[model samples]
Target: MAYNFKNGRESVGDEPRSGRPVEARTDNNVQRVRTFEHQDRRITVRMLAYELNLKRETVRKILTDNLSMKKLYAKMVPSS
Candidate 1:
């Protein structure tokens, strides 16, 4: 039996043994979130995920990990 490092197990020449699960959102979500942030609305993580077509976790990571992105998101919120 040959070892398939790509996904573990044997490879059937070129076909995938199984299909991977699809993500709920696409790259378009990133654009949408940026747009919303520019509009000056307090975008919650959940709402942004739904409207932007991204997973809540993904959006959270993007906002937290990227400084520029976080800054852009911050601009959307109004000061209390």
Candidate 2:
């Protein structure tokens, strides 16, 4: 069985996301974020975001999730 919409708006592939797009998260960006954090533990999220041209949340995710780190007393350190 197949169901299709005759409207011109219909597309054959997945639609774009609802947000600003997923450019912030990438292998290169992740490595860059790690390098920046390693160079300065006290680097602020705002600074990282600005340097990488990514949103604060995206930078934070790279730090916490990708790097397994967390903010501790205004510093980024290992989660464990």
Q: Provide the overall lDDT of each model, using Cα atoms, as 2-decimal numbers.
A: 0.58, 0.83
- Top candidate when judged by lDDT against the true structure: 2
For model 1, residues 1-80, the per-residue Cα lDDT tens digits are 45466558554676645675455334555556667766645767788778766787877655554314443544323222
Q: Model 1: which ten-residue window has the lowest total lDDT?
A: 71-80
For candidate 2, the 10 contiguous residues with the lowest summed lDDT are 1-10
Predicted candidate 2 versus true structure: per-residue lDDT over 1-80, tens digit per residue: 12555445466786667976656789998999988877887789899999888889999888888888878888778988
The C-alpha local distance difference test score for the whole of candidate 1 amounts to 0.58
Cα deviation of 18, candidate 1, in Å? 8.2
TM value for model 1: 0.45
Where does model 2 exceed 4 Å of error? 1-13, 16-23
Residue 6 Cα positional deviation in candidate 2, in Å, after optimal superposition: 5.6
Best by TM-score, which number? 2
- Which segments of model 1 are wrong by more than 4 Å? 1-28, 67-80
